[model samples]
Target: MRHRVGPRHARRPAPTLLRGIYLPRSMDAGAHAMTTFGIPLLVLATTNSAVLTGVAFALEWVPRLAAFALAGAMVDRYGASPVFRTASVLRALTVVAAALALPYSDGVGATVTVMLLAASTGVLSEFSYIAAETAGGAASRAAGSRAHRVQSVLLGIDQVGTLAGPALAGLLLERYGATGMLTVIAGFSLLAGLLAPRQRDGRAAGLPEPVMKGLRTGWSTMRSLPTLCWLVVGLTLSNLAVGLLQAAAPVIVIQHMGRSSADVGMIWSVAAVATLVAVALWRRAIDRYGLWPVGAVAAAIAATTCLAVTLTHTYTTYLVLIAVLMAAEGGMTVMLRTLRSHLIPASAFGSTLALSALILLAPFPVAGVLIAVTPPALLVHVMTGCAVLQAVGLAVTFARLRAAPGLRTALA
Candidate 1:
């Protein structure tokens, strides 16, 4: 008979590789599937006019800002896993509804209304994403790096989907028309919903406290910590800068370069590839050096890269600039996510994390408006300035954190 023994007196326990590393990758795939279907559905269902499309797109962000706070509180009350599963299913159902509505819309007015409804429903998925990250906990911050590594990997995959979804939608639309495309989207949504149940067994049994209690607890906890407060503030500013840059990228490519759709796709693909590589490298670096220095370096690099974008005119030069900028952004993102995982207690995890997301996302509409109103030259200038500000803010925050013994130890 084979004998299995516990660690003997003279021996140590075997080192085990963490399984949580795979969890982020899986969650990321699920996120990619969700976004892939959601974005195309908006595109496929909308009128071809840029103005109408912009209006529909703008509606999507509206609910995201409005509902984020409540979603965070509810996530704490219900627990991340359960909330994630429920929202996934709800999002799938909403997509299915959008699929149904697509066939009926005859013109811009009808299409806009249906697309607006679709975008509104899609916001729920964002809530579920925040919850999933919260559930990741310290496993999210394993090896001194944060969820950013996982986020970057997943985001890379998501970008692939972003690249693929439109092409797939176009093919499907050509083959099966609007109805056929919607059917394909519905299938993706169903897959996403099915994936949710696998997150954690028995997650439903541990219902959190009431929403009010959870909010109060989260508020108290956040208010008590100076590090958490400043971190959120800095991240919020960073995200605002990111949002503006993102909204402006396509506009710059289209207007400045007079690029066709294919060229635009190529530019984005290059940026995505760069982000993926930077993130993978940043993850390794963070595991070795820790988040503070990695983040500081990333911020500085991002600032320079953003400024470089304004100077580039040729397609190759612009692509190179974008790739470099995205790399830096990807690195900073990983560090910030890791820091967020560290700062919050497990019990208040979802709410606190969600609050940070809410704050960070608060300026998206403003960024979008800036994209709409400002001249391309002015917008690019503003984005470069913002990137510089983000670098300075992150540096200052890092300095404050390094000086404070409690915060420094926590970060380390």
Candidate 2:
């Protein structure tokens, strides 16, 4: 009789998931950030109108925010590979079309063209992102007990992309003009599409779900998972405080603190570094202390730093506090991602991911409204109010999680 191989030994060798999934993800994310940030600056340059620039910002983000649910549904129905590849290819084409159109258009025509490009790309980017996120979620689930390590690395990769993307966008725009910058973005987007892994054969592709129905499904998934719901609630409150601080950063730095616009960028650069460090540390921390304790500690640190930021009189102090706050947030994010992979069923992962993201992001526009209406001198006070709410909410959330009998195995 011939010798038989065990299942593990018989499995075919494959490229590491990190190289196959995350490398392309980084390219996609950076390109999206470049286009999103670059377009507003381009609008300002082309129109010489701050109003149009502000319009460009809204056009870019509003559509992106709207696309999450639909994109998530598409990912669930069709699978991540096909959705990501199609959206990325379409995004590249859109950018190239805009670049080709820009030279011929003049004044209002140029402004309109750019705004349309922003809206289109914004929607496409969300589709790609949701698909990629679903793909990552599948990979995390396969990792089983080591899932948080996967999540920490993924979060770290995102932080790096976010840190580098804007600066790269500005540099390319300054050196190469609209066409050059757009062309570079298109290249990255195309590369991301080309690099995406092929879909596995076993998963079924189905008819597109209605957007509203998909959202309802996502909502149902959340309702089924009380632990996930409570974590989202705490994070949403934390984000409200973070969002207020972010929206108020430029005004506080340039007007209240008497710092240049350049300093605002520097502050974020520092904070991003802090976040990266925290993400790196989370894996080891989780290994030693487990997820719940690590998350609770992170929450406490974030809440403390958020409150302390209100007392800062100097730019340096504000910068340090913000960095610490972001670091803590990074740790919490890793914990969230790990838990999400464990809790949400694979069948609803895409749709539920969309709903969770929407909830987390809802605070941003609210923060923007607060910043727009509040006096600069009162910004700290607004942040203080948000911080207190975040602290109490998270404290309560963790306390509940700790006491809940249903969550012990999952948290363990």
TM-score of each: 0.76, 0.84
Any idea what lDDT model 1 has?
A: 0.60
- lDDT against the true structure, per candidate, is 0.60, 0.80
**Candidate 2, 1-412: lDDT as tens digits:** 8665767634656647866678889889778767755676676567755445545655676777789899888888888888898999999999999999999999878888998998899889989888888888888999998888778778877777656665566566667778988998899899999988765422466677899998999999999988889999999999999877766665677557877544665676677788898887877888777778778999999999999998888999999998899899998898889888889999999899999988887776577567656665677788899999999999998997886443333332
Error of 2 at 207 (Å): 2.9
Q: For candidate 1, what is the total of clashing residue pairs?
A: 2
Q: Which candidate tops lDDT?
A: 2
Please provide the root mean square deviation of candidate 2 (C-alpha atoms, Å): 4.5
lDDT of 1 by residue, 266-314 (tens): 6555676677777778877776766666766787787677667766778
Question: How many steric overlaps are in each model, in order?
Answer: 2, 0
lDDT at residue 394 of model 2 (Cα atoms): 96
